[model samples]
Target: MKAKVYVTLKKGVLDPQGKAVANALETMGYKEVKGLRIGKFIEIELDGASQKDGEKRVKEMCEKLLANTVVEDYRIEIV
Candidate 1:
């Protein structure tokens, strides 16, 4: 089984890095770039787990370590 996790800052959180990237893009003449946000993508491989089980485990991993629940939200996908 394989799983993917996406971690991103929640609304209302300060994203200095994302802002910086957006500014750089604007400076480079990408004026259509109105906003940007930074995030993390994690891929994991699992052995002998069904799709349901894999998704559950990946969710636990995100809650425990992969994402900071206070300011970040995560989404999980199993394949």
Candidate 2:
């Protein structure tokens, strides 16, 4: 099984990196660029006995290391 994970900062958290990118875009004349948010994408290939098992493992991976739940949210999709 393959899992795609997205980890992103939750709303209301200060994103300095995103802010810098947005500011650079504005300076470069991208007037339509209103905002920018950065996130992480992790694609993992795993061998599991069943979909349920894969989900459980992926959930553990996200919670234990992939994401910082206090300031970020994560979504996992199996493919």
Candidate 3:
């Protein structure tokens, strides 16, 4: 089994990196860009766990380390 975790800044948090990228795009003639946000993607391999258990473990990982839970939100997908 495999799990994919997505981590991203929560709304209302300052995203300097995302802002910088938007500014660069504007300077480079990609003026159509209105806004941008950046995030992280992680993939983990699980050892033959049931779907329910995999999800539970992944959620724990997210809460413990994968996401800040304060300034960031995470979504998980098991496959």
- Compare the candidates by TM-score and give the number of the best one: 1
- 1-79 per-residue lDDT for model 1 (tens digits): 7888999999999999999999999999999998899999999989997788778888999999999999999999887
* Residue 61 CA displacement from its true place in model 2, Å: 0.9
Model 3 Cα displacement at 33 (Å)? Answer: 1.1
Question: Candidates' lDDT values, in order?
Answer: 0.93, 0.94, 0.95
Worst 10 residues of 1 by lDDT: 49-58
Candidate 3 per-residue lDDT, tens place, 14-43, comes to 999999999999999998999898999999
Q: Residue by residue across 1-79, what tens digits does model 2's lDDT show?
A: 8999999999999999999999999999999998899999999999855888898899999999999999999999999
Q: Which stretches of candidate 1 lie over 4 Å from their true place?
A: none
Shift of residue 26 alpha carbon in model 2, Å: 1.2
Model 2: weakest 10-residue lDDT segment is 47-56
Worst 10 residues of 3 by lDDT: 45-54
* Candidate 2 ranges with C-alpha deviation above 4 Å: none
Model 3, which residues run further than 4 Å from truth? none
Ranking according to lDDT, highest score first: 3, 2, 1
